[model samples]
Target: MLKIQEIRELIKLIDKSSINEFKYENDGSKIVLKKNAGTAVSYQTEEVPVQPVVNQAPPAIESAPAAEPVKASPEVQQESKAAEEDSSLHKVVSPMVGTFYAASSPDDGPFVKPGDQVSKDSIVCIIEAMKLFNEIESEVNGEIVKVLVENGQLVEYGQPLFLVKAE
Candidate 1:
């Protein structure tokens, strides 16, 4: 088990570095910390095989140095709204932390793309971890609405790879 002071120190270190996520495991206890936008830090820990703890810090607000209100353009606002609407779709998530590949090989076409119909066993993408190529399957029958990640993007476990509209 990690002491509260030790966890605070680790959080400070992570805040000072460019690392967005960190994971530590020992003796069946595991801790995962992730940094997201808006200075919100989320953490999940499993102290025992059957018990888990999750914590999320309140979002922090920073005052603008110039005290000027910044506004997003209409196009940007529309895009953000679209993204929110797409959140209702089913997501095909990564099962492990790795580099995501859109195809089996460099020369091969992607396994699936936006608007492609996929069954429960369809291969959606490949993830390369520890020098092994792992084919990721879509466990839900649907039409792929969007490819969330680009080819060769680094993805964390449980990260959404593709959004699908269930049939």
Candidate 2:
């Protein structure tokens, strides 16, 4: 049987590698991992038999195809360049899989927007998971540089939802 830690390592390995899918089998257990077209990853593991799993080194990150260039308006281009050059920018990632909400309700304004100031513990957004609405906070003092996800969009765990330029 594969331990939980082993499974986590495999997940991290697969996420970093260029390969899109991975499979492994031992005893009566079978494991298959597949990455989605978006940022999410999913995997399946079957029942285990008697054999112990052996550990192996992680796979190296391979070079993938170059992406096509994106064209944008002049103002957007400047903002993108500035964001790329800023080293103090911090990404606020989702802690769990959920639908992203820019505000508490549809009629309410967003908790924060681009150029808005935020401090540690500020509730910048909400994540609805399993019927629970979780207020996501910014852990660093910063200015909201960008919002990566749209309201009412499904977000995966560890996906970056905002870019903040730390003060």
Candidate 3:
């Protein structure tokens, strides 16, 4: 079982992170933390078999009125066009859920950036999971065309980290 202090620390970490949900399992204990639509956060601790903390269902609320659809701005359109152009590019995706680091450390420069050339084995970024820093590599020889995630953002498994135009 996880001690209260450790659980509190985990909650605070999750609250400060961009990740919406985090699941941790140790021994026979499991902890699930999830953020709601607003600032509210819900968490639960259970054994091997996951169970709800409260058996009662929440009261239903009426749906809000539908709003008019807004048109996309010039920047949004340009980004959408760029995304379409990147379809042929090779995407470097995160192998695991973690915090993305553009550089090896705060004092160092990023391994690669947009328009930077990279070999198949070139390190592109770092992903920190469970206190372990994993150096992520570009598996294809290419020029980095775009970076998908921001530094210090939480990245999910298989989420695209960089887009490369293969040579």
Q: Judged by lDDT, which candidate is best?
A: 2
Clashing pairs in 1: none
What CA root-mean-square deviation does each model show from the true structure?
17.7, 14.1, 14.6
Ranking by TM-score: 3, 1, 2
The candidate that achieves the highest TM-score relative to the unseen native structure: 3
For residues 26-124, what per-residue lDDT tens digits would candidate 1 score against the true structure? 665666667765234334445435332234567578865632223446875565447536756888889998888999999999999988999998899
lDDT tens string, model 2, 1-167? 78889988988988898876677777656776666553233334454343432343345689877444334568765765667556778989899988889999999999999999999999999999889999999999989998877788788899777889898
* Selected candidate, larger lDDT, 1 vs 3: 3
In candidate 3, where is summed lDDT lowest over 10 consecutive residues?
38-47
- Go through the candidates in order and give each one's C-alpha lDDT: 0.77, 0.79, 0.78
- Stretches of model 3 off by over 4 angstroms after superposition: 1-81
Expressed as tens digits, the lDDT of each residue in 58-133 for candidate 3 is 5579987744323456775577458746679888999998888999889999999889999998899999998999
- Model 1 reaches what TM-score against the true structure? 0.51
